[model samples]
Target: MSTATVASAPPAPRVQKRGTPLAKKRQWRAAYLFVIPFFVVFITMLIVPLFYSGYLSFFATRLVGGTSFVGFDNYVKTFTDPLFLAGVGRTGLFLLVQVPIMLGLALFFALALDSGRVRGSKVLRLLIFIPYAIPGVVATLMWGYLYGQDFGPIVQVLSALGLGSPNLLSDSNVLGSMMNIVTWEFVGYNMIIMYSALRSIPAELYEAAEIDGASQLRVAWSIKIPAIRPAILLTVIFSIIGSFQLFNEPSLLRNIAPNAISTSYTPNFYAYNLAFVSQNVNYAAAVAFILGIVIMIVSYVVQLSTQRRERLG
Candidate 1:
């Protein structure tokens, strides 16, 4: 019987654990796999186009001579081109007027929401944000119709009231009208940025402010505004970029506003017209890069100023 007993199965082979280096290697591989898609798209869509455009900026394409490298000739021409210079100035005006009004309204709304005194704050916030959710093109078209002197609500109201309709589409008033539309579209987005920053502040600071009998205004001025300066700076930078990149509304409204919105109303508009309408892709690439450089410089200046302020503070 003892001799006939079945041999016990050999102990199962021990499973080998992955060593530290192997585990790290596997983790890195997975991380790289996750990142590869974004890198590919970024290079294909943004970086490659940017470099190609940069290369083109150094060359000039002529009707008779074809394309030839001209060093910084394109850059010099871009800086001196009257149309491009006018577009840059127009864009600067847009930034100066629209940015302040938009940011001011946004800050006000954010402060009101953070006050905790407004009724139905969530509903109000949602309503405020609805305009931003709309596509810029749609918003432009809707507002363009509203500004119409023909059958729009504004004209109808004025007619009913026996008052003459103000021409919002007129060259004299069109820039202001554009400002209003931009402000309406972006105020909420900026408000959300500020409100989020306000929300992130430590509750203890609020409590302490309250203990000192600080009013809502004082608390906001001293505690909230100072606390959210970085967020405000971020919004300022974003607004600056958006102001310079003012293409969609003007472009979409061009059909209805040919008299007011010129083909080169903004630097972006100029680049677009040059590339598509005039069939001047090379020079358009140059203008586009020049604007990009300007944006980069402005943004860098803003960030640098903020850094210096932080160091001083």
Candidate 2:
């Protein structure tokens, strides 16, 4: 024991040597250098502006030096505004009807294209997706012209077929017409998303299903749909968000059918009109914030409900 103690084990090989302060400082500097740009941009563009908006939302601005803190008056006014409520209701209606139809068409097209037996699949896919590449303003303009009652080819065709041409740009039919435009522009985008999901599914699953006597339809329903459920949910959420944000199409089309789409056609359009036309920035902020919250809550609920159903099944 005494001989072993005399060896002293060389101070346990300095197992926990601490770094110098200069070395620690250099490590911290490198980390900050890597992270600073992101923080700088986020703070400058997002955080600061958001905080500024929050502050601005508390006051009512006037033409003269008459800005005054109004507290929640703007929000109260927004809630009571019939035009705002109508816009919200119209957007909800569009979300309920158009989103499902558009996404359904997208899923169908994606599935059709992903099936190896389809002829001219590549060309068809390119043709389908080309509409999405057109600018929204341009698409709206073109479709607005086509939907024209006086000189449109559709009207001419209806006249030729001895069927009376209904006014597509009337107040009663404008929402449906806009829905058609949105579907044409975005179905391809959603199709691409679903197609990507379809491509990622392993061939082995389909092969195994085929070996088990599953028909193509059964395989698509059981394997393909379940596999791409997440992408489907994503497209649905995006469609819902977009339906609420409907502006450019109706706004641009207003030139052709002014009475059909007023200043407040959708929630986003309502906010725009409030801010610019009404000169009510505070009310616009309130409406914008409310719309954002509604979208977030709806998306969260949809995701949760879908996930729960999947888990339970």
Best-matching candidate per TM-score: 1
Collision count for each candidate, in order? 0, 0
Model 2: per-residue lDDT, tens digit, 1-313?
4334433445443432654444445556766877999999999999998878777778898888778999988778878889888999999999999999999999999999998788999999999999999999999999998999999988889988999998999999999999999999999999999999999999999889989999989999999999999999999999988988999987898898998899989989889988999898887888887788888998899999998998899
Q: Model 2, poorest ten-residue lDDT window?
A: 7-16
Can you tell me which runs of candidate 1 are displaced by over 4 Å?
1-22, 156-164
Poorly placed runs, candidate 2 (over 4 Å): 1-36, 63-65
Per-candidate TM equals 0.89, 0.88
lDDT of 1 at 311: 95
Model 1 over residues 275-303: C-alpha lDDT tens digits?
Answer: 89987888898999999989998889989
- Which residue pairs in candidate 2 collide? none
Displacement of residue 180 (Cα, Å) in model 1 is: 0.9
